[model samples]
Every structure is written in structure tokens, then in C-alpha cells.
Target: MARPSYLARRAGGRYFLQIRLGKRAAELFQLPLLRVSLRTSDFAEARRRLVDNLGWVLELIEAPDLEAIGTVFDVRLRAYVDRGSPADERLLAERCAFENEVRRYFTRAQERGYAYQKRFPEIPGRWVDFVDQNKAAESSITRLTARRSYEAGRREAREAFNEGWEPAPNKAPALRPETLDPIAMLDRLVQDAVGRRMAQLAPGNLAPVAAPTIVPAETGNPNEPAKSDGSTATTPDRMSILLQEFLRPAGRKRQHTMKGRGEAEAVVQFAIDFLGDPRIDELTEEKWKLLDDALPDIPNRDNIPREFSQTLFQRFKYAETHGWKDLVRVTTTTIQSRYWGGLYKFLDFVIEQKLYAGPRPKFVCIDPENLAPLPRDAFDDTELLQLLQQPLFTGCKNRLHVWQPGGYFVQSHIYWGFLICILTGMRPGEVGQLKCADIRTDGEFYYFDLRPFDARSGRVALKDLRNLKTNAAGRVIPIHPILIELGLLDRMQDLIDKKEERLFPEWEAYIRKDGTVRWSQPLSKSWQYVKKLLKLSRADLTLYSTRHLMADWLDNEAIAQRTRDRILGHANDVRGRYGRKGILDPEIAAKIEALEPAVIKQMRKMLLSAKNRADAGGLTVLKTY
Candidate 1:
């Protein structure tokens, strides 16, 4: 026995010409199989039909280009539809003709059988009985009530015959020399696979044709340049790889910080997961819409448990013990900033690299106006005093290791960090990342320099490299009288004596996977602990509230708009821009330092009361503070 082809199959006592595709082909076609009944039980007839079908299949597979294959299939379909004459009309006509033919066949059979019965009366009990039976069958076909049922059976038989029948050259559309192009046919096949439903073709019996491998136009080797015609002949780049390239740090000028890059990666990874990690070129509008629709459903990590797992076993154990908790839902503002923001940037990169064909995607969903406005959690003087007097600032044993245990003494860095932020309006990260060298004094005034460390300076270790959030964030702010009065300068001197670089060395530095250090995390945790201890946990205030409070205070004081903008690292207006260069002027510094005497008095009282309380309790305060 000869080997059977993958396309040949026998079902219900009939041979079928089935199109069975491999996994890759099925994915490309978006279909698992294309099966057509040959309408014949004879193996020879099935083989002949298969041979006829293979001719076109082989031609399509062997096409030199997609364009050629597309043209062929387009012409074939047009010609086939044309042969039937306007499809609906021709189909109706064919059905009526088939019904009439079935009626005639029944009529002939009745007449011939009845005539035979009459001629040989002795052959049956009665010729009249045979004639009556034949008349009854004929009436069933002719009757209006039975007409629909009769036509249905006739239509089915006609369809079966048509499936097995091959129309002659004149009756059917001919494959013109121009239309025989295999490339055109394959292109059409692809279009059908993507744009619409695929048509099933009848099976034929012919010599087995091996399944042809289909190479998509967008696929290509990464290292190799694409063909001049803009076709790639290999695998396309994975979305993950493309995303990495898009988010990769360019140079010092355009480089994204480790945290920024990580956030961008997270956004892009969400898109990749939503799109099933399709090739970069395969990111269609439809798939993108799915991601957009699914954004609202994606569980947020806002309130999820923060567990530390250093090993696979530890991770597994944590999951097993904790199980999965309900994730917090993200807000529209988060979607706008994190999701749409990152996606729009990536789209720009894709356009810049010419990675995709046709027009670039317009990120209409990234509307800033869509983001809901949130009220700033500014603290009043009383709340500020309460926050400062918390255990983290006074003398709580460092239960969470968030702060250094100074016995009964407060961690001076955490104490001063909050105080400085309240007075200077500096961000938590900015305060946490301060270095001893950043605190400098001119003959006239003392100030803190908020600037990125020089990359060439070997003295500044990799983990100690200072990175400002933005260009506008780098500025010098005059040291508040309260900070100086509270011995902040003295603390800097002590750190310098120890040769420590960071201002707050006790606050642990968190090294991210990208080898960059984050100094703000511990301070943020300490603030949270403080909030919880002070019974202010339900308050909307965060460490950031200090900056808001300072802004409110400065605004109420009727401070110069320019001075306030400069102090807060906000974008300056045109008037504020005039006559300003690097390093603030002495006059402006004086104006910033001149805070209300009442505020200073309140701060001093709060600090003193906390200290006296700890002393009265016989707690051994760290001698330095």
C-alpha cells in the first residue's frame, strides 16, 4: 500500500480532501483546519479531485511574492462569483431548476412503474393497487403543503452532486495566464485569513502534495537588513525585546532613571501580556483596543501586601501561606500617567525606528484632562506638631527597622528631614538623598544644593550617585533658621567626621535591580509607621504633605511668586525668570529665611517638649542629638 497524504481522509464512507495545518500555519491563518467533503466514496474519484485542487495550492505556496499570490486569489474569486451571475439571483434560479428536475424524475418513475404493473397484472395482487401507491407518492411531491419539504430534499441532493462535480472550461471561470500567479493567490489567502472568513474548498483525489511552509511578510532575522521591497523573510522581533530597546537609556542627556525605566517596562509588559506577546508589527488596532478595554479590569497593586522574597522557595512559601488577596483597583489618574503615558512614549519610539508600517498610532486615550483632580493633603500647624511628636521622631524602639534605634533618643535625621521639608518645601526624595557636601555656606548664607552628582567623580560611589527628578528640581535653597537652630549643621559636621557621603546614612538604601539606589523608601516607611503610631493613619497626609503645608504657608505670607516658585522647584513665570541665574541671590535668600516668628516658636516648643518628655522618662537619648 502507498503512503497516504496528510490532506486525505475517509469519513462516513466517503473520501474527503481536508486541509490540516501545523501549529504555526494555524496561528497565521487564525484557523485550525479547512475541510471539504469530496462527495464520493470511490478513492479514485477523491484522488482525481485532490490532484486538481493541489495544482492551485502548489501554485500559491510557490509564489515568488505576496503581491502575486494576492492578485491570483482575488482574480479567481471574482471570476468564480461572476460565473454564477449576481450570486443571490443565480442561487435562487438554481434552486427552482433543481426542484423542477426532482419533480420530473418522480413523475417519470411513477408512470414507468405503473405501466409495467398494468402490463404484468399477474406479477402483483392488483395493478390498481400499484397505480394508487404511485399516484399517492406523486401527490406528496405536487401538494403545496409538502412542496417545501420536497424541495429541501431535492436541494440537498443537488448540493451533493455539485460538490463532486467539476464545471467545464466554458461554464466555469478560467484561470487566465495573468491570474495563475501563485504569490497573488497566497496574498489573497492571507487577506481572507485576516480580513474575513475563509472559504472552504471541495476535496479532490490527486497525488499527495506536501504541506507548504508559509513565511509571513513581517518576519525577518534581527541582524539582517530587510529586503528592498520592505519584506522580512524571517521571524519578527518579540514585543519584549522591542520594548527594551524603546525604554533603553540613550545617553546622560535622554537617559531614564532606573525607576522611570522600570515603570515604563511595567506598562509595556502589560501591553505585551494583553496582546499575547505578538510580534511588534502584529500589534493591530483591534488588539490595542482589547488592552484599552481590559485596563479597567486589571487588578491594582496599590494595597497589596509587600512581602520580601529572595528565593524561589521563599516566594512559593509566601504564596502558599498568604494565598492571593484582592488587589486594589487603580484610578483613572494612574491609568493616564502610568499606562497611557508610557504607551504613547513607546509609540513614538516605534515611529522613530520605523518598526511598523503605515500611519503611526494616535494615543487619544492619554488625555490629561481625563485625570481626576485630587486635593492636596496639606497639614495644619497642630497636625504638623502631632506628626513630629510621633514615636519615630521621639523614641520608639525601631520595631520595623524603618529607623535606627537610638535607645530613647530620636533618629535626628528623620527628625530634621520632616522639619526641613516643612520649612523648605523640599520633596522627601530630595531630602533623603542629601549629602553632607550638599550643605554649603557662602560668607553671607548657608544653603543646600539639590543637583545630580557628576558621573566622572569616582569619589561619589555608584550607590551614592545623586539623581534629581527633573532639571527644574535642581536648585539651591537657603537653610531655614529653625533647621540651623536645631543643630542640623552640627549633624552634617559629625557625618563629615565619619567620612560618610549621605546625610542620612542610618536610613537604608534600597538597590533596585538596575543597580540604582533609592534612598526615599525607608523614609517613606518611617513616615507611615509614624502616622500609624500617632493615630493619624486615616488622615490623607503623606510625607508630601509637608511640601503642601509649606506652599500654603508661603502663599498666606504673601511671599513673592518668584521666590515661592524658586523655593518649591515649580516652573517659573516670565516675571519670575528675569534676572535669575544659578545660585539664589542673598536678598532672595534673606526673604525666604524670614519666616513668621510664631511658626518658629511653635516648632521649637514641639521639639523641646518631645525631648523633655523622653528625658523625664529616664530614656537614654543618643548623646549627639
Candidate 2:
């Protein structure tokens, strides 16, 4: 009953280990045996130890062995690839963009299995399959020979699969994860469950881990043992709060400004809801796809349907405008391109803010071909004027309202406001903050310097400049001779003579509501009211429509480039001369003086033409989003 002496004998020119497995002969990995001498003292101890090691090797040859080896390799790859590996500091410290991409890869992997994975090129799941099969002894033999360890296992597996892609009938059920490292295997499963839980509970919110500083969470299951890895993950509520904090307004340069913090909040909220990994660094593409799918399902209750409805909604819109809309829309590209740029900006915010770690966001395919602009005649010639000429004093029923009978300029506040936008293209906030004092009429020349309204959030001061949408938006429009002929100049001068500093203050106020002081808001309700009369095509009409209409005329026909630039108070292609205090305002005024009634007449004529055209030209009404 004695086991044979240990010998790796070569009958042919090859290497082999004659494993003593209960009288069976298994020639593993094609290794040739060199010695099989049954000696006493020379090979006695080797024979004894070989039997002991054989027992150890038999224990490792358990079920699900390939998966166990594969998992370890994956962990090692993670460690090697992490940028923070050298410093040993990777606690979700990555940009949101990169994290989003990684999540997308994993989610896709789970859905379609390993064959569909599209991450880095080098790594493959099949390599893990090799080690998981518990054929390392064969692998070691292969290594000793000319081939690799895993290669031998793969070869054997392939041979077996060719016969039947399953274990023989009498074999044990797979040990799988437990065979390689049971505790670590279970840990991975638990993390995956946690990932699934957070994704389900709050889309983008990740529950926290109970680490050194944090108190342990009170669990739903008291009997469940504490995680073997010391740290516990986040809960949904805490993550949401953190995400909100991250999106809250910071300073003037923040993506969201006071005027449009609502949209900014919405963008950040979208990031949070999609990526559930509140660490921001943990966000990935899979989360965004999930969130993207979820967004359309959430009802939009605003005039701009996609824009969320809340006090904070405007802020988010305003913020988005700064980066997304304003920047892109100014270019002469298609509307879809502009919107794509807007999406790009939001995706960057996800990255910059680390809503997740990875690359730039992966967007679903949006057919840019679907986008089309409002017809040129949609807001052309007569329609704009007809919309504007309605009585200013009238209620919000139509395009124009009836004005109240009173003092010359005082009674004409609303009319004058629309007039200013038509002639000068000043925004609502600019008009709301304008002062009669700022208008200076010297001889035949008249000009007004617009300044941004200064506001504050708590103790933090906000910006003051030409409160136009962007830095490029600042311009000084000249008074038209037609405006002079219509007696609008005389009317404005009359208001100045009366010593009224502010042209309009009816809507502006500082309210002490419930002891908290707050500034009055801008004129959007009025814009919507105006939208009724201007019932230009729904897409073509907005508070900004007047500005767009006027600019087109001014730039194309009415004024020469130098004269237009001068009238608009822009420097004459001189950059360095601007910084000096001695730049003459008088020169700017003289330029504005050169502009005549030609611009006004051309604008009016264009409007008249547009009025005669058919309105059914574009799908402006349908594209509210």
C-alpha cells in the first residue's frame, strides 16, 4: 500500500510530474519527466514533502475556480490603472465625466455579458476564466515548459467544451467565487448589491460608508453583521443633501446667477439624480443614461417645458444660459447645434463638479437633423410693430396694451419700454433699471449709458456692469431721427426736465417680507404677456425677438460698420486705448450723431412686409422643449 517514490521521469524528450493521485496517471501541461529513480536517502525527503503538497494542491482544485482567479486579476488591474495609485489616495477623487464612463461600461457588461464590453482594449474576462478553473498545477507545468500556465488551462477547457460545455454528470456543483477567496468574493457581491440599492433608491445618490470619523448607520436589519471592510457606504437622504449643497449658488461667476439660478439648479439636480454616487467623483455614464431616460418621464410644468418649475428654476436657466445657451446661440449655427453645445456645457459641469468620475458624458443619439429654425418671415416686418404698438396701459390680454392717460412720459412707461427694445434692443432688466438722468441730449445727439443692477445674496455682493446677457452684449444704441420725428426724444427730455431720476420704478422694490429683505425680480411675466400680442410664431417670438429683429436691420443695411459700432458705444477696433482713463465719451457721442432715420424706416418697412406673409411656416409652436 506504499505510495511510489517521487519521480518526474522522461521516456521521451519532455518534462513531466508523475502526480500520485490514487494509481491514476495525469500528464499535465506536456512537461517531460527527467528522473524517476526509486532511491532512498537522495529522494526520500522530496517523496515525503511531495505527498504533503499534493494534498494541498487537491484542496485548491475546487469548483468555480476560474471565476475566483479572474476576480483577483480584475482587482489588481483596478489598482494598477488608478491615477491616485502612487499616492495611495483614491477615495472617489475623480472628475464626474470619467466616473460616468466607467459606470456605463460596467452596466453594459452586466446587460450583455463580457463579449460586449467596450472599455480599455487590453483587458479580457476570458483570462480570468483560466485561473478560476483550478488548473494551476497544469499551468505551472506549462510555465516550466515553453507555454504559459493559463494557456494550458484554456486548452484543456476548450477540449472539454468541444466535447460538452458542462461538467461531467457525476461532478460536484461549482464552488465558483468561494474556491479562490470566499470572504473577498462575498465582499464584491455585497458592494454590487449596494450599488444597485443606491441606483434604485435615488438614481444618482450614493449611500455613504461608515468610516473612521462617521458614526455607524442604524440598519433595517439589526442581525446583519457589520461589513468586514470597516467602511460603510452612504444612505440616500444624506447623499441628496450633499448634492444640493454642491449645486447651491457660490459666487457671481457661479454657473447660476441671481437672475437665472433655477436652470442651474436643475442641471446640477439632474446630475445628482442620475449618478447616485454623491461623492461626485463616483458618477459614471451608466447613471447619466438612467437619469436621461428618467428626465422625459418627469413632467415639465413651465412655459419652457423642459425647464423645471420652481423658484430655483430660473436660476438654473440663467446659469445654463451663461455657459450653454448664450454662448452657443450667439453663433450662426443651426438651433440643434446650439442645443448640442448647451448639452456639452452641462456635461462638462458634471465632470468639473465631479458628479461622477470618467470621461465627458456619453449622450444618447440626438438627431440634429430634426432641428429647424423659425422662418425668416416669422417675426418679420409688420408683425413685430403690430405686436409692439398695442396700448401699453391695457391688461395682459393681447400683443399690445392700452396706455393710461396721464403726463407725457409718465403715462407712456410701458410703450417707451417696448420702444427702447425695438430701437436699442435693451433687455428687460436694463430697461427696468434705466434712469432718465443717464440719457444725455447734447444739441442733436442723444445717448444713454446703461449700468447693471447691483444685488446681493446674504452678505455676498453681486456683479455690476452692462447687465446684458454676456460681455459681448454691451452696446450703446443711437437715437434715430425717426424717433426724434415721432417726438419720443422730446417725451424723454420732458421726463428729464421734470427731474425724475429713474424712468420707471413701478415694478422695482425692496420688500421686507417676513423680516427677510429681498430685491424685486426681473420682467418675465411681462415678457409672456407681450408674447401674446407678438403672437408671432411661438418659436420666433420672445422678449428678445425685438432685439434680434432690430440687430438684423442695423447690421445689414441701415448703418455702416464704423458708424454702427460708434452708435453702439463700442471702441473703434482699439483694444489697448480702452484701458486708459482718457478715452473720450465725446468721440463716442459724435459717432452716434452720424446715425440717421434710415435705420428706423428700414426696420419699420421690414416689419410691414412680414405682416403680409403667412404665419404657418415653421413648427415653432411644437418645439417648446
* Best-fitting candidate, scored by TM-score: 1
Per-model TM-score, in order, reads 0.53, 0.41
lDDT score of model 2? 0.43
Q: Which stretches of candidate 1 lie over 4 Å from their true place?
A: 1-236, 244-259, 301-329, 365-373, 394-407, 452-466, 514-516, 537-539, 574-578, 597-599, 609-619, 623-625
Candidate 1's C-alpha lDDT? 0.60
lDDT of 2 by residue, 572-625 (tens): 565522321211255554544343345456655543332222123311111000
lDDT of 1 by residue, 1-625 (tens): 5624734666458665556656654543345764444445666666765664555454443445333444444444344334432223223222232223223323433444433222332322222233333345445444644777889988988997789954355666765775487898899889978654323332442334445444443343344444534454334476767876765655555444335555566667767655656777777777777667655444444434455243222333344455536333456777777777777777766777688774555444432323353556888677776766566565656434424344465545666677788888998778877889899776678899775542111124444545666556767788887677666777889888988887877666777644556667856876787777667754467788888888887887788777788778887667765553345878777877886546567777777665666657755556332
Q: Kindly state the number of residue pairs that clash in model 1.
A: 19
Score candidate 1 by TM-score against the native. Answer: 0.53
Q: Per-residue error at 589 for model 2, in Å? A: 6.4
Q: Point out where model 2 deviates above 4 Å.
A: 1-239, 249-261, 270-282, 289-357, 360-364, 368-370, 373-381, 384-389, 393-410, 441-444, 451-462, 481-501, 509-541, 555-558, 562-625
